[model samples]
Target: MTWVGPSACTLPTVEQPLRVAEFDALFAGAVQGVAPPGPRN
Candidate 1:
């Protein structure tokens, strides 16, 4: 069986925990300055 979703966004080995505020900050930062690779073109 093959499946892909948000859960597949990362690898299974490393674990980088993030706080809600930290995540919100990162998301906001991305929107403000950093340009993500974004969806496939």
Candidate 2:
């Protein structure tokens, strides 16, 4: 969760919910190029 970006004054504010969700999914190890976790038998 280390957001290394420019200062608030340097960047414009905009809502990017999708991008956030995408990154969250990636960081949470849920959007990799492999089969997702399945239920146990």
Candidate 3:
């Protein structure tokens, strides 16, 4: 259930939550949407 792959960011495990919080705060007002899964090629 990890949010990203090992190379996604340099933050250590303990610091990830803080980074997530920062993103959440910055994007709080962003538009929200979802798309249905597309068929596999």
Q: Which one is best on lDDT?
A: 3
Misplaced by over 4 Å in model 3 are 1-3, 30-41
lDDT tens readout by residue for model 3, 1-41: 65667789899989988888887776676737657899989
Model 1, span 1-41: residue lDDT tens:
22335465574434323343466677777775756697997
Candidate with top TM-score is 3
Question: Using Cα atoms with residue i matched to residue i, what is each candidate's TM-score against the true structure?
Answer: 0.31, 0.36, 0.50
- lDDT for residue 1 in candidate 2, whole number 0-100: 55
**Candidate 2 lowest-lDDT run of ten:** 4-13
In model 2, residue pairs whose N, Cα or C atoms come closer than 3 Å (at least 3 residues apart or on different chains), thus clashing, are none
Q: Which ten residues in a row have the lowest lDDT in candidate 1?
A: 11-20
Candidate 1: pairs in clash: none
